[model samples]
Target: MHYQITLAREVFCEGVGLHSGKPATVKILPAPENTGIVFIRTDLTDRPRIEAVAENVTTTLRATTISKGNIRIFTIEHLLSALHVYGVDNCYIEVNGEEPPVQDGCSAYFFAVLQKAGKKIQNKFRKEVVIDKIYRIDDGERFIIALPYDKFRISFTSLNEHPLIGTQYADFIVTEDVYAKDIAPARTIAYEKEIKHLQDMGLGLGGSLENVIVYNDAGWINKLRFNDELVRHKILDVIGDLRLTGGIVKGHFIAVKSGHQLNTELAKEIRQGGC
Candidate 1:
């Protein structure tokens, strides 16, 4: 039987927030079975806690943000993606700021750290969300469809107007090994023309060439880890976003130009549907 798992020991990392640009440190600690993934803002006086679930998701602009009353956490997708892939069911993520560190703008660092921490199996059996029917969310141009499948999988098609990154497609059965080697290392992508506008809006201030892959009208400003890195990153985001369902999902997701908003919406639907 599949058992619930948590970190073997506490582990921590430090970096700057992708959007907030503020320096922050995050510590992951083990929790008991059935606790689920939770986040705590240690910088606040009350030290409010927010469970990482779809119901707490408040914003999905450029990133996913979860809130509990006035307290909030931002840009949590990368970290959650790593934890989900690692099969971590229960943990406490303690952070010194509103956002977790944007290490290398990808899940690779987080995945490596989690691997080093190892896993502790609990007595309780894990419950997974098994999709028995199709669930679809469409917004004209973009759409996401969840289909019944025995394994966790994703088939994504990314579309961009830029000639350099017009259309790309990829499908994979997301296993821990595949995620660590193929999906986790893909860095976040941004456009040169949008950088100034994003910074002006008080976002992506901490982003740099070392972390984000930027491209201009002519071509990419930074080297790509893969020719279809952008679509792979989209799959990474979808994995993280879906983890908000509060359990491992057993199904296949087919997406076309789906972003955080659509991903989270489908997550909420799945949760409410009790699938």
Candidate 2:
């Protein structure tokens, strides 16, 4: 590919952080080719720059990405996912506080704002880190594997372990059209018990019925877009976490109950020539 793209103009959104309970504002600005996606902590006086890279990953408590040169931002997966699928080659995301807004706990808001701004293609060719072999990592029962493939692909399996979630399997061929329609609207879900625990820990401060699916021991309070929505969300997360590699990836991912920690580790492995 001889072209790279960025937003045509700036876009803005504001909301509270699900974990921090603090309000935040995010602004997206188009960047030149080779700039990549970077997060600027404008709330700080020094204004630290945090590259969305696996090496910068500091935490993965409830969601992915907590990189910082000084202060940290929490829960950046959904916004990052939107950027990845939308093929945003380079951009500067300035957050007035830690954490991007958990708008609806999905990528829909980011997509809408990005679509409205349109995209500008640059002259430089884009680059991708291709997987050349099978590389795997595991944490307890969770595991993620990257196998050689030409186009990006993902397969996921999740067992909610509750009567409500059961076990789910989902697969997708990664592409913009498929992501926009099939994956972008799927919201993050949580068990009521977990939500309570998160709240007790002073986390998930911004979680609500409107932004997240609340599942009880019995079943979901609402319906899901797909039968395997839980697994599909896991796939969406992998796409976002892998973007920390600083470019596109050409590989097939086989994930079994894998979370951000494992996904980030796999990206590091790939960069180290382990895959």
Q: Please give, for residues 73-187, the per-residue lDDT of candidate 2 as tens digits.
A: 7788888888987888899999998889888878878888888888999999888777888899987799999988888899999876686677888889989888887788888
Question: Per-residue lDDT for 1-275 in model 1, tens only?
Answer: 69999999999999999999999899999999999999999999888999999999999989999999989999999999999999999999999999999989999999999999999999999988789899998999999999999999999999998899999999999999999889999999999999999999989988999899999988999999999999999999999999999998889999999999999999999999888
Which is the leading candidate under TM-score?
1
Off by over 4 Å in 2: none
Error of 2 at 159 (Å): 1.7
All candidates: TM-score: 0.99, 0.95
Q: Show pairs that collide, candidate 1.
A: none
Residue 236 Cα positional deviation in candidate 1, in Å, after optimal superposition: 0.3
Error of 2 at 51 (Å): 0.4
